[model samples]
Target: MARLDESARGVYLIAVTPFTETGALDLDGCDRMADFYLEAGATGLTLLGVMGEAPKLTTDESATIVNRVLKRVDGRVPIVVGVSSPGFAQMQALTGRVMDDGAAGVMIAPPGSLRTDDQIAGYYEQAAEMIGDVPFVLQDFPLTTGVQMSVPVIARIIKDIPTCVCLKHEDWPGLAKITALRKEGATARRVSILCGNGGVFLPEEMERGADGAMTGFAYPEMMTGVVENHAKGDMERARDLFDAYLPLARFEQQPGLGLAIRKYVLYRRGVLANPTLRKPGAALDPLSRAEVDRLMARLEKRLKELN
Candidate 1:
């Protein structure tokens, strides 16, 4: 597989880790999930992300999932595994293992302990040194990580780290940041910027110079539709497709319940055999499930009307 680089684009779905009803790793379900993402028009896959329940898994379990999905994907598209850990040793170890196992690249999110600008910049310098030539996605998700990366700081990192090839832009109200980073001479080199936050701001982000999305929205076709149409200079068509999925996208953005909603929808769509999340996770109640069903029905009706 080709290494992920600045030229990367399109929807890179942050894949969910599938589990059985007993919460065991579902290797078969992983294969089914990989097929579903590719069939839905994903250009790449990001596994072991926060959405993939990374911290909950043991090292062996994480490797098992990565290898399973890599074999299933068979180098069809670039696969980026999140290797954010409290220690650089673990991150380096995981990066080496996955890269050896055919992964294209890895993602690193700043730990919440990082506060000062120098601290943030120094951390990436250390990380890049530790990983040693492995291309990495700098995940700038302030809401989840509580580590705010200013545009100047981001530009500095991109300028300083040659191996930092992409930015996972997940900061809320971050469209301006994208514009800033894209300005001429903002950095030594331009890195691919893929927006997150479930892709709710993808249309605006693209307009602000984002390459595409790296989110876990269950209805990925909506994301692919938006990106494709936007690239074709069809803003109206892009927004029309986005509006159709907005309601469910908003519903799934709810904190603590988002993953459950996504898993349930995937299961209902026959992408997963079970909607089970591992322990220390939340599941939707009966009423919430029914509400999701209603939203899905409405989405179907809206899509049909659009067609």
Candidate 2:
């Protein structure tokens, strides 16, 4: 597969790590999930993301999942694996392994320890050096990392790191950041911007200059639909599609329960064998599951009406 670069665009779905009811890795379920994402119109795949439950996986397990998905995808689209770690050695090691295993690139999120703008910019500079020539996506998710990256700091990183090719823009109220980055000579060069936060802010992000989304939602078609319609200059159609999924999207954005909700919805959609999160994770209660069911039913109705 070609390396991910500034030209990358469209929905790069952040995939979930499927598990069996017994909590073992579900390789078959991984295949099924890959097929589902591609069929839903994803242009790329980002695995081992935060939503993929990355920290829970041992090194071997992470490699297993990445290889499994890479073989299944068969180079159909670029595969970006998350390699964020507290240390550069681990990040560089994983980057080498996955890049050797046919991954197009890797993603690195700022650790919460970063406080100053210089620290943020310096970290990416060193990371780029440590990872050698491997292209990387700079994950700017202040909500989870608690490390806010202002537009100037982001531009400095882009200016200093040649291999930093994309930004996973997940900062809340971040539309202005996108606008600032796209302004004349804001950075040394252009970098692709893909919005995250499960794509809730994708329409506005795109309007502000994002290329597309790099997030997970059980209904990825809604994301693809929005991007496609927006690219065609059909803002009203894009919004109508977004509105139909907004209820469930908002429901799934719940902090501790988001992944559980996503897994349950995928299982209900017949994409997963089970919705079992690893230990130290949460699961939906019966009432929450029923509520999700109702939302799914309503989404189905709304989609039908739109069609």
Candidate 3:
């Protein structure tokens, strides 16, 4: 198994699941996307995320996608798969299969039913046991999971679960959480903290002690540049590059419309051949596409000025 640890730091792009115009899984596109992300400076790839249309995939389809991504990735970089299921059995099975398929780790978000801190902590304890030593990422994105883990609660989970290695930190206004976790004596062990609000909060998050980012913005090179610049102590350059991409990043962060915009940008950049989304997904309308086109045009101009 590919093990993800605190030493892991950089852009881990949450990949999009592609489909044919007829709604069939685009396995070819998966291979292409894996290669594209790596070449674009992504240190890792996260699959089966919410933006990946995970729930729409059947068990067999999920396995096939994981297998295909691992095969294409071919051990170049770590792969993390989301295994946040309602049942432990399903989570266990998916985690096992993906780990067996060469995944580095699994990401788990608390189920919506979890209310109190005890319920959240207990669920992770049970999940850690079920997964049996597979390193996992605690996805603390409240907007999607509806489970808000306070700082103390997160520290408690880290203290108790040795296998909880990294956090996909997407809590809005989450800089304080990063600060709390990175603060001295917050926890016995320190784990990697990667922000995931579509890279909108990345500059401030990095400034607040986040390791890096793990969001699926269409242009991952933007994230790579920001993280690298920050690590080099070039705060001015990092902020400049981040500002250059901020408009599109903000535009792409729109909830219901974001995925469509991202897929279209990927398609326009030739990373994907088609922008077809699976059923029940939002597709880009003419006006939306035009808006994305304008954003891309302005992004090009701004990037040129920065360069």
Q: Each candidate: what lDDT?
A: 0.95, 0.95, 0.91
TM-score of 1: 0.99
lDDT of 3 at 251: 93
- What order do you get sorting by lDDT, best first? 1, 2, 3
* Residue range 1-307, candidate 2, lDDT tens digits: 9999999999999999999888899999999999999999999999999999999998889999999999999999999999998899989888888999999999999999999999998888889999999999999999999999999999999888889999999989888889999999999999999999998988898899999999999999989999999989999999999999999999999999999999999999999999999998998999999999999999999999999
User: TM-scores, in order shown?
Assistant: 0.99, 0.99, 0.98
- Residue 112, model 3: lDDT of 97
Which candidate, 2 or 3, would have the higher lDDT against the true structure? 2
Residue 151 alpha-carbon offset, candidate 3, angstroms = 0.3
The lDDT, on a scale of 0 to 1, for candidate 2 is 0.95
Worst 10 residues of 3 by lDDT: 1-10
TM-score of 3: 0.98
- List of clashing residue pairs for candidate 1: none
Instruction: Assess the local accuracy of residue 172 in candidate 2 as a C-alpha lDDT between 0 and 100.
Output: 91
Candidate 2 Cα misplacement greater than 4 A, ranges: none
